[model samples]
Target: GEEVAQTPKHLVRGEGQKAKLYCAPIKGHSYVFWYQQVLKNEFKFLISFQNENVFDETGMPKERFSAKCLPNSPCSLEIQATKLEDSAVYFCASSQLGPTSIGYTFGSGTRLTVV
Candidate 1:
Protein backbone atom coordinates (compact mmCIF):
# COMPACT_ATOMS: atom_id res chain seq x y z
CA GLY A 1 0.00 0.00 0.00
CA GLU A 2 2.94 2.31 0.59
CA GLU A 3 4.76 1.53 -2.62
CA VAL A 4 4.43 3.46 -5.82
CA ALA A 5 2.35 1.52 -8.38
CA GLN A 6 2.70 1.76 -12.17
CA THR A 7 0.50 0.12 -14.74
CA PRO A 8 1.31 -1.75 -17.95
CA LYS A 9 4.78 -3.07 -17.36
CA HIS A 10 5.50 -2.65 -21.06
CA LEU A 11 4.04 -0.60 -23.89
CA VAL A 12 4.48 -0.83 -27.65
CA ARG A 13 3.74 2.12 -29.88
CA GLY A 14 4.24 3.01 -33.49
CA GLU A 15 5.91 6.25 -34.41
CA GLY A 16 3.43 9.10 -34.16
CA GLN A 17 1.17 7.08 -31.86
CA LYS A 18 0.15 8.38 -28.50
CA ALA A 19 1.76 6.97 -25.37
CA LYS A 20 0.27 7.50 -21.94
CA LEU A 21 1.70 6.10 -18.72
CA TYR A 22 0.30 6.25 -15.21
CA CYS A 23 1.86 6.22 -11.79
CA ALA A 24 0.03 5.96 -8.48
CA PRO A 25 2.31 7.26 -5.76
CA ILE A 26 1.95 6.37 -2.13
CA LYS A 27 -1.26 7.92 -0.85
CA GLY A 28 -0.84 11.28 0.92
CA HIS A 29 2.50 11.85 -0.72
CA SER A 30 2.91 15.48 -1.67
CA TYR A 31 5.43 15.16 -4.47
CA VAL A 32 5.84 13.06 -7.59
CA PHE A 33 8.87 12.57 -9.87
CA TRP A 34 9.18 11.25 -13.42
CA TYR A 35 12.34 10.26 -15.26
CA GLN A 36 13.24 8.72 -18.58
CA GLN A 37 16.07 6.28 -19.11
CA VAL A 38 17.27 6.39 -22.67
CA LEU A 39 19.04 3.63 -24.60
CA LYS A 40 22.44 4.88 -23.57
CA ASN A 41 21.67 4.22 -19.92
CA GLU A 42 21.42 7.88 -19.17
CA PHE A 43 18.46 9.10 -17.13
CA LYS A 44 16.59 12.12 -18.34
CA PHE A 45 14.34 13.97 -15.95
CA LEU A 46 10.87 14.34 -17.42
CA ILE A 47 8.78 16.12 -14.79
CA SER A 48 7.93 16.29 -11.11
CA PHE A 49 5.57 17.70 -8.46
CA GLN A 50 4.16 19.23 -6.15
CA ASN A 51 5.49 22.27 -8.04
CA GLU A 52 5.33 20.33 -11.29
CA ASN A 53 8.55 21.34 -13.01
CA VAL A 54 9.82 20.18 -16.38
CA PHE A 55 13.57 19.77 -16.09
CA ASP A 56 14.67 19.67 -19.71
CA GLU A 57 12.89 21.15 -22.67
CA THR A 58 15.17 19.44 -25.15
CA GLY A 59 14.49 16.08 -23.60
CA MET A 60 10.75 16.66 -23.27
CA PRO A 61 7.99 19.25 -22.84
CA LYS A 62 7.48 19.43 -26.56
CA GLU A 63 4.05 20.40 -27.86
CA ARG A 64 3.12 16.74 -27.72
CA PHE A 65 4.51 16.02 -24.27
CA SER A 66 2.63 16.62 -21.04
CA ALA A 67 2.58 15.47 -17.44
CA LYS A 68 0.28 15.95 -14.49
CA CYS A 69 0.02 15.07 -10.84
CA LEU A 70 -3.59 15.44 -9.87
CA PRO A 71 -5.35 14.87 -6.62
CA ASN A 72 -7.57 11.82 -6.23
CA SER A 73 -5.88 10.20 -9.20
CA PRO A 74 -2.61 8.71 -10.29
CA CYS A 75 -0.05 11.01 -11.89
CA SER A 76 0.26 10.76 -15.65
CA LEU A 77 2.75 11.36 -18.45
CA GLU A 78 1.42 11.60 -21.96
CA ILE A 79 3.25 11.92 -25.23
CA GLN A 80 1.31 12.60 -28.40
CA ALA A 81 2.83 11.57 -31.70
CA THR A 82 5.66 9.83 -30.01
CA LYS A 83 8.96 9.52 -31.86
CA LEU A 84 11.34 6.60 -31.93
CA GLU A 85 13.58 8.47 -29.53
CA ASP A 86 10.77 8.37 -26.99
CA SER A 87 11.34 4.69 -26.45
CA ALA A 88 12.68 4.42 -22.93
CA VAL A 89 11.87 3.29 -19.42
CA TYR A 90 9.91 5.90 -17.54
CA PHE A 91 10.20 6.08 -13.80
CA CYS A 92 7.88 7.59 -11.18
CA ALA A 93 9.05 8.35 -7.68
CA SER A 94 7.06 10.01 -4.91
CA SER A 95 8.18 12.02 -1.95
CA GLN A 96 6.39 12.57 1.31
CA LEU A 97 7.71 16.04 2.06
CA GLY A 98 8.53 17.57 -1.25
CA PRO A 99 11.85 17.29 -3.11
CA THR A 100 13.84 18.26 -0.06
CA SER A 101 12.70 15.17 1.73
CA ILE A 102 15.02 12.24 1.70
CA GLY A 103 12.28 9.66 1.87
CA TYR A 104 10.97 8.76 -1.56
CA THR A 105 9.27 5.71 -2.96
CA PHE A 106 9.92 4.65 -6.54
CA GLY A 107 7.93 2.45 -8.83
CA SER A 108 9.43 -0.28 -10.97
CA GLY A 109 8.68 1.90 -13.99
CA THR A 110 7.04 1.54 -17.39
CA ARG A 111 8.98 0.49 -20.47
CA LEU A 112 7.87 2.13 -23.68
CA THR A 113 8.98 0.80 -27.05
CA VAL A 114 8.48 2.87 -30.17
CA VAL A 115 8.83 1.38 -33.59
Candidate 2:
Protein backbone atom coordinates (compact mmCIF):
# COMPACT_ATOMS: atom_id res chain seq x y z
CA GLY A 1 0.00 0.00 0.00
CA GLU A 2 1.14 3.53 -0.77
CA GLU A 3 -0.02 7.01 -0.04
CA VAL A 4 -0.14 10.33 -1.82
CA ALA A 5 1.79 13.13 -0.18
CA GLN A 6 0.93 16.82 -0.39
CA THR A 7 3.18 19.57 0.89
CA PRO A 8 2.60 22.97 2.43
CA LYS A 9 -0.31 22.07 4.67
CA HIS A 10 -1.61 25.60 4.30
CA LEU A 11 -1.20 28.63 2.12
CA VAL A 12 -2.47 32.17 2.30
CA ARG A 13 -2.16 34.89 -0.29
CA GLY A 14 -3.58 38.21 -1.29
CA GLU A 15 -5.77 38.62 -4.29
CA GLY A 16 -3.87 38.34 -7.58
CA GLN A 17 -1.01 36.49 -5.91
CA LYS A 18 0.27 33.25 -7.37
CA ALA A 19 -0.24 29.98 -5.54
CA LYS A 20 1.63 26.78 -6.06
CA LEU A 21 0.75 23.39 -4.58
CA TYR A 22 2.86 20.30 -4.68
CA CYS A 23 2.01 16.61 -4.61
CA ALA A 24 3.88 13.35 -4.67
CA PRO A 25 2.02 10.41 -6.06
CA ILE A 26 2.36 7.07 -4.32
CA LYS A 27 5.33 5.10 -5.47
CA GLY A 28 4.56 2.62 -8.27
CA HIS A 29 1.33 4.43 -9.00
CA SER A 30 1.10 5.93 -12.44
CA TYR A 31 -2.01 8.02 -12.09
CA VAL A 32 -2.24 11.31 -10.26
CA PHE A 33 -5.26 13.48 -9.62
CA TRP A 34 -6.00 16.95 -8.31
CA TYR A 35 -9.22 18.12 -6.78
CA GLN A 36 -10.55 21.37 -5.33
CA GLN A 37 -12.99 21.39 -2.45
CA VAL A 38 -14.88 24.58 -1.72
CA LEU A 39 -17.73 23.14 0.25
CA LYS A 40 -17.76 20.42 2.81
CA ASN A 41 -19.67 18.00 0.60
CA GLU A 42 -18.49 18.86 -2.85
CA PHE A 43 -15.33 18.01 -4.74
CA LYS A 44 -14.30 19.41 -8.08
CA PHE A 45 -11.94 17.29 -10.05
CA LEU A 46 -9.41 19.64 -11.55
CA ILE A 47 -7.03 17.47 -13.48
CA SER A 48 -5.48 14.01 -13.81
CA PHE A 49 -2.22 12.62 -15.06
CA GLN A 50 -1.15 9.19 -16.15
CA ASN A 51 2.56 8.77 -16.10
CA GLU A 52 3.37 12.40 -16.70
CA ASN A 53 0.72 12.71 -19.38
CA VAL A 54 -2.61 14.40 -18.91
CA PHE A 55 -5.34 11.78 -18.87
CA ASP A 56 -8.42 13.84 -18.21
CA GLU A 57 -8.97 17.54 -17.53
CA THR A 58 -12.61 18.26 -18.14
CA GLY A 59 -13.15 20.19 -14.94
CA MET A 60 -10.10 22.39 -14.96
CA PRO A 61 -10.24 26.09 -15.64
CA LYS A 62 -8.87 27.14 -18.98
CA GLU A 63 -7.05 30.14 -17.61
CA ARG A 64 -4.99 30.91 -14.50
CA PHE A 65 -4.60 27.28 -13.52
CA SER A 66 -2.05 24.76 -14.65
CA ALA A 67 -0.63 21.46 -13.47
CA LYS A 68 2.28 19.15 -14.13
CA CYS A 69 3.06 15.58 -13.12
CA LEU A 70 6.59 14.85 -14.03
CA PRO A 71 8.46 11.63 -13.58
CA ASN A 72 11.03 11.63 -10.80
CA SER A 73 9.62 14.96 -9.68
CA PRO A 74 6.78 15.98 -7.47
CA CYS A 75 3.56 16.97 -9.23
CA SER A 76 2.50 20.57 -9.02
CA LEU A 77 -0.58 22.67 -9.46
CA GLU A 78 -0.17 26.39 -9.98
CA ILE A 79 -2.63 29.20 -10.04
CA GLN A 80 -1.26 32.25 -11.77
CA ALA A 81 -3.62 34.62 -9.99
CA THR A 82 -5.48 34.08 -6.79
CA LYS A 83 -9.04 35.23 -6.19
CA LEU A 84 -11.41 35.14 -3.26
CA GLU A 85 -13.45 32.45 -4.94
CA ASP A 86 -10.33 30.35 -5.33
CA SER A 87 -9.92 29.79 -1.65
CA ALA A 88 -10.35 26.11 -1.03
CA VAL A 89 -8.65 22.88 -0.04
CA TYR A 90 -6.71 21.26 -2.83
CA PHE A 91 -6.25 17.50 -2.65
CA CYS A 92 -3.92 15.16 -4.46
CA ALA A 93 -4.65 11.51 -5.14
CA SER A 94 -2.91 8.59 -6.72
CA SER A 95 -4.13 5.35 -8.23
CA GLN A 96 -3.14 2.66 -10.61
CA LEU A 97 -4.94 1.65 -13.76
CA GLY A 98 -7.07 -1.49 -13.85
CA PRO A 99 -9.85 -2.84 -11.78
CA THR A 100 -9.23 -2.89 -8.08
CA SER A 101 -11.40 -3.04 -5.02
CA ILE A 102 -9.48 -0.24 -3.40
CA GLY A 103 -9.33 2.98 -5.30
CA TYR A 104 -7.44 6.22 -5.01
CA THR A 105 -5.44 7.22 -1.98
CA PHE A 106 -5.81 10.91 -1.19
CA GLY A 107 -3.53 13.31 0.60
CA SER A 108 -4.62 15.51 3.47
CA GLY A 109 -4.64 18.51 1.14
CA THR A 110 -3.40 22.06 1.16
CA ARG A 111 -5.75 24.73 2.38
CA LEU A 112 -5.40 27.82 0.25
CA THR A 113 -6.89 31.05 1.47
CA VAL A 114 -7.06 34.19 -0.57
CA VAL A 115 -7.52 37.44 1.25
Candidate 3:
Protein backbone atom coordinates (compact mmCIF):
# COMPACT_ATOMS: atom_id res chain seq x y z
CA GLY A 1 0.00 0.00 0.00
CA GLU A 2 1.09 3.60 -0.49
CA GLU A 3 0.09 4.56 3.01
CA VAL A 4 1.80 3.78 6.30
CA ALA A 5 0.60 0.60 8.01
CA GLN A 6 0.06 0.08 11.71
CA THR A 7 -0.74 -3.22 13.35
CA PRO A 8 -3.21 -4.42 15.96
CA LYS A 9 -5.91 -1.79 15.53
CA HIS A 10 -6.92 -2.08 19.16
CA LEU A 11 -4.94 -3.28 22.16
CA VAL A 12 -6.11 -3.58 25.74
CA ARG A 13 -3.85 -3.98 28.75
CA GLY A 14 -4.10 -3.75 32.48
CA GLU A 15 -2.32 -1.02 34.31
CA GLY A 16 1.39 -1.76 34.65
CA GLN A 17 1.35 -4.10 31.68
CA LYS A 18 3.45 -3.69 28.60
CA ALA A 19 2.20 -2.24 25.30
CA LYS A 20 3.89 -2.42 21.96
CA LEU A 21 2.81 -1.00 18.59
CA TYR A 22 4.31 -1.45 15.17
CA CYS A 23 4.42 0.81 12.12
CA ALA A 24 5.62 0.18 8.60
CA PRO A 25 6.58 3.30 6.69
CA ILE A 26 6.03 3.85 3.02
CA LYS A 27 8.62 2.13 0.83
CA GLY A 28 10.78 5.14 0.06
CA HIS A 29 10.36 7.19 3.22
CA SER A 30 13.42 7.44 5.41
CA TYR A 31 12.05 9.34 8.38
CA VAL A 32 9.39 8.10 10.74
CA PHE A 33 7.57 9.82 13.59
CA TRP A 34 5.32 8.62 16.39
CA TYR A 35 2.55 10.70 17.89
CA GLN A 36 0.20 10.18 20.80
CA GLN A 37 -3.35 11.43 20.79
CA VAL A 38 -4.68 11.44 24.29
CA LEU A 39 -7.74 13.61 23.87
CA LYS A 40 -10.27 13.78 21.11
CA ASN A 41 -8.19 15.88 18.75
CA GLU A 42 -5.05 16.81 20.61
CA PHE A 43 -1.84 15.14 19.48
CA LYS A 44 1.62 15.10 20.95
CA PHE A 45 4.75 14.32 19.08
CA LEU A 46 6.64 11.57 20.83
CA ILE A 47 9.62 10.56 18.82
CA SER A 48 11.15 10.46 15.37
CA PHE A 49 13.74 8.22 13.80
CA GLN A 50 15.73 8.65 10.62
CA ASN A 51 16.43 5.34 9.00
CA GLU A 52 18.02 3.32 11.84
CA ASN A 53 19.02 6.25 14.02
CA VAL A 54 17.12 8.30 16.53
CA PHE A 55 16.48 11.70 15.04
CA ASP A 56 14.57 13.49 17.81
CA GLU A 57 12.83 12.06 20.84
CA THR A 58 12.46 15.06 23.10
CA GLY A 59 8.77 14.46 23.59
CA MET A 60 9.07 10.88 24.75
CA PRO A 61 8.47 10.33 28.43
CA LYS A 62 11.88 9.69 29.91
CA GLU A 63 11.14 6.40 31.61
CA ARG A 64 8.33 4.47 29.99
CA PHE A 65 8.54 5.12 26.28
CA SER A 66 11.09 3.75 23.91
CA ALA A 67 11.05 3.36 20.12
CA LYS A 68 13.10 1.86 17.33
CA CYS A 69 13.34 2.00 13.56
CA LEU A 70 15.27 -0.76 11.92
CA PRO A 71 16.18 -1.13 8.29
CA ASN A 72 13.92 -3.55 6.40
CA SER A 73 11.71 -3.85 9.47
CA PRO A 74 8.71 -2.02 10.78
CA CYS A 75 9.28 0.70 13.36
CA SER A 76 8.08 0.06 16.88
CA LEU A 77 7.04 1.92 20.01
CA GLU A 78 6.98 0.10 23.30
CA ILE A 79 5.87 1.24 26.70
CA GLN A 80 7.40 -0.52 29.65
CA ALA A 81 4.97 -1.06 32.52
CA THR A 82 2.25 1.11 31.05
CA LYS A 83 0.30 3.48 33.22
CA LEU A 84 -3.32 4.50 32.98
CA GLU A 85 -2.26 7.75 31.41
CA ASP A 86 -0.61 5.77 28.66
CA SER A 87 -3.94 4.91 27.16
CA ALA A 88 -4.24 6.70 23.87
CA VAL A 89 -4.19 6.38 20.10
CA TYR A 90 -0.69 6.16 18.70
CA PHE A 91 -0.14 7.51 15.20
CA CYS A 92 2.78 6.75 12.95
CA ALA A 93 3.92 8.89 10.03
CA SER A 94 6.62 8.77 7.41
CA SER A 95 8.37 11.31 5.22
CA GLN A 96 11.30 11.62 2.90
CA LEU A 97 13.32 13.84 5.26
CA GLY A 98 14.39 16.75 3.10
CA PRO A 99 13.26 20.07 1.73
CA THR A 100 10.63 18.20 -0.23
CA SER A 101 9.29 16.79 3.03
CA ILE A 102 6.43 19.20 3.37
CA GLY A 103 4.27 16.92 5.53
CA TYR A 104 3.82 13.38 6.70
CA THR A 105 1.81 10.38 5.59
CA PHE A 106 0.03 9.16 8.71
CA GLY A 107 -1.30 5.75 9.55
CA SER A 108 -4.80 5.08 10.84
CA GLY A 109 -3.34 4.71 14.34
CA THR A 110 -3.51 2.06 17.03
CA ARG A 111 -5.87 2.52 19.93
CA LEU A 112 -4.27 1.39 23.17
CA THR A 113 -6.45 0.93 26.21
CA VAL A 114 -5.08 0.63 29.70
CA VAL A 115 -7.37 -0.29 32.48
Q: lDDT of each prediction vs. the true structure? A: 0.83, 0.90, 0.92
Please say which candidate is ahead in TM-score: 1 or 2.
Answer: 2
Q: Mark the 10 consecutive residues where model 1 has the least summed lDDT.
A: 51-60
Candidate 3 lDDT for residue 16: 92
- Global local distance difference test of model 3: 0.92
Q: Which candidate is the best by lDDT?
A: 3
Per-candidate TM-score against the hidden true structure: 0.87, 0.94, 0.95
TM-score quality measure for candidate 2: 0.94
lDDT of 3 by residue, 30-86 (tens): 889999999987999999888989988999997989999988899999999999999
lDDT of 2 at 105: 88
10-36 in candidate 1: lDDT tens per residue? 999999999999999988777888889
**TM-score, model 3 to reference:** 0.95
